[model samples]
Target: GEEVAQTPKHLVRGEGQKAKLYCAPIKGHSYVFWYQQVLKNEFKFLISFQNENVFDETGMPKERFSAKCLPNSPCSLEIQATKLEDSAVYFCASSQSGNTEAFFGQGTRLTVV
Candidate 1:
């Protein structure tokens, strides 16, 4: 596809439930990133991959948060145990290269209660 696609526009999870989001990057893109947007104007980088390999994960949570990018499959971000603070929008972005401008998906909104 020419645009990045994200699945399940909205997700509601209990405090201890698991939440998983998927993103299909534009064909031919080599870099993918997952970001969490808590506030309307604030975005926190969660992780990034370069052709199915971890490129950077410095902003990923040490626990409960995990992600993956694999060949022939869409990238994913999973939360093992949802927390109240985990309520936010998860956006997936992809770029042709690390220095190129990224294209973002519509985003998945997760609400934990």
Candidate 2:
């Protein structure tokens, strides 16, 4: 099992500002994912990448959210425009190909005020 690393445990931004979250996928794992948790029961899958190439992004917001998992760099999830509704815990996850469970990092809590 490998661990996903995330930076900046907390982020604060004003309305209309930008918020960026970073993730480091586990070594040897090819799939990396991002999710937004606004409530305990709700998790919105944001995007996924297979070794720097996007695999599935059906859940990503078309207008405001963007993500990348480029090689030799930390995977990043960014919100171009901050909103009060965007305040939430953003989680990063990673897994190896096939039959492997995904591992999540400590979420980055974003606050928009």
- Best-performing candidate as measured by lDDT: 1
lDDT of 2 by residue, 1-113 (tens): 25788988999999999999999988989999898899664999988888989988999887999999888899999999899999999999998992489899998999999
RMSD of 2: 1.5
Give the lDDT of residue 17 in candidate 1.
97
TM-score of each: 0.97, 0.93
Every model's Cα RMSD, please? 0.7, 1.5
On TM-score, the candidate that comes out on top is 1
lDDT of 1 by residue, 34-85 (tens): 9999967599999999999999999999699999998999899999989999
